[model samples]
Target: MKSSPLALGLLALGLLAPSVRAGLTAGMQEGKVELKSISQLAFGPEGVLFIADPKAAAILAVATGDTAPASGSATLRAEAINEKIAALVGTKSDDVIIEDLAVNPISRRAYLAVSRGRGPDAVPLLVRVDVQGQPELVALDRVRFARAELPDAPADVAPAAGRKGGSPRTESITDLAYADGRVLVAGLSNEEFSSTLRAIPFPFSRVERGTVVENYHGAHGRFETRAPVRTFVPYRIGGEQHLLAAYTCTPLVQFALSELKPGARITGKTIAEFGNRNRPLDIIVYQKDGRDYLLMANSSRGVIKVAAEQITPAAKSITAKVSDTDGLKFEKIDWAGVAQLDRLDARHALVVRTGAGRALNLETMALP
Candidate 1:
């Protein structure tokens, strides 16, 4: 799975695609709606979907064929980790934040990345809950984070500054994915603009520790490299296990899982870089009619759709314009926090957008 340096160099240049393009159609007809601050999202077996609202400290269950007022058709379940996670991390029940949620496909279990900062009781933990209603911190000791370096800061104060700085180092895991019998976690370093990707082996009953797969510097290739990653989705492309990473500051970056295994160098080619200057905030990959498509939610623009084939090397340039059904032009709304797009059937999807306060928007869109 080794990519020649020549191919990798070409990838670096190909990543810089202009944001200006025409043909994007927007409107309520395209299934656009307002939503609360959506912190995380995932689709369950069948047509069931889940959205995590960390600000609300609750997970909402939305049934199929639902739209706005998702709270009506959605069952809001309060996270049970309020007290337990707090005790484990030695932080206030309110501060023991649940940053990301990962569902195990095999065991049907759920894992949460809980961060407690730097207090005596503050120990970031990777916690898991099985289907039988049992919950425990899985990889507590394996979780290690280097405080980002800050300007004119003392060594001891670096970690604290990094935690307070920006999107990258917020002292929490921004995204998590379960694949190939392992758990992948992405964390941001606020003081310095960077994020680290770590992998934890699965089947917790057998292993007690996980290894740091890659200590990725946020700005390794592009000019604005430190933009913290907004989403990481594991997918198999062309019979190889690869990961599609979307940054809040840059376009998408792809890497083979083999390149991330222990002792492997951190060199990944930029497969496809799309979206505007505002940074792509969310992304999801799903199959429709036996074809794969990458759906991206941008902070400046709305959702952009691209077929998997359009991103391959042969395509050269992938282009699409957003437009309404009536051929009218529509502007992208101010998207906030976290959002998710999930497959509904062969031709449609369920989109959930969450923002500040209690705002939550849900819509159903037909794929083009």
Candidate 2:
């Protein structure tokens, strides 16, 4: 197949993408990674990928070394790759569903969260695709890993029927982020009454069930919700660091890390509202001209770039609706179907984008 002009241009930018700069670490030694359960994933410091396990109530950090994805990797169409993955796991193409996508900054390889079927039969598979665009099983046997279990498990509300089959075991983990020696997790319990965040300190010490983060939304300064953060990246404004979290109906709220103490009820400052009925997929903090920007991917409105400085001195909350160029203006990127994204380095972001004919393509592109 011949490459279209658009594909060629994207390839050219990919060639110039930034290289991984993470330092090496002692890859897995003891404390095996139990794949019995998993919901969310995020790359932490020292080439560690934090895996959230709510069943055993533990989070695992596995060592993945610094190997960048092949720079000019030819596209590996999602349909074809899914077939191959199915073959490896003894299933047909229709039986597998790609739940999530994340790229390792250290390896440049993409990780795919897959379910064998759904509900109780929904066995999860962690697969990695390399530069050649080949799918490989991320075998968990004998890898360096550390685990930390959440000391608290709140009661469950009746789960939403699993994906067509009600696979409630794995759908609880909504998002994960790593920053400042802590792994921040956002999840919804079975009860679904409220959402929660967990800041697990690395080196396997303790799990801190984070404070409840609520935001004043909609008009009239009311209509708050405990909707879990779908995806987030740590951002710094001034001298303080904060978790820039996105909730359902799409409100971008910031919660200071210092104030997220255990059992404390905290409210996040609503900085920007993406739109109503929108589900935010991924977010990354990027910089240009020494100015910072927050890039968010959504299920419907495409990818958007928000000026980070707007939030530093923002209103206490944005209670009204915003048009595209209104308060905390958002400029949408022309690229469509970005299911997940992560900053590979300063100049580029690794993305899982929708390909022609319902396929998924993992590629690196210039930062917007």
Error of 2 at 230 (Å): 1.8
Each model's backbone clash number: 29, 9
Best model number under lDDT: 2
RMSD score of candidate 2 (Å)? 10.4
Q: What C-alpha lDDT values do all the predictions have?
A: 0.45, 0.67
lDDT of 2 by residue, 1-368 (tens): 12467756766777422211112234235644666666677877555777776656667778765444446433333445666677778987677777676667655567877777756557767788765667888877767776666655554355655346554443367888877767777767665466677676555543343344433234325765555667777887667888888776557877778766776666777777666657888888888889898898888878889888787744456655457323477898876878767776667777777776745666677888
Against the hidden true structure, what lDDT does model 2 obtain?
Answer: 0.67
Residue-level lDDT tens digits of model 1 in 183-287: 565655446555556555432222323443443422324322334557877877667788878766444666777676553436334455553465665566767
Question: TM-scores of the models, in the given order?
Answer: 0.49, 0.79
Q: Which candidate tops TM-score?
A: 2
After TM-score superposition, what is the CA distance of residue 120 in candidate 2 from its true location, in Å?
A: 1.7
* Superposition error at 192 for model 2 (Å): 4.3
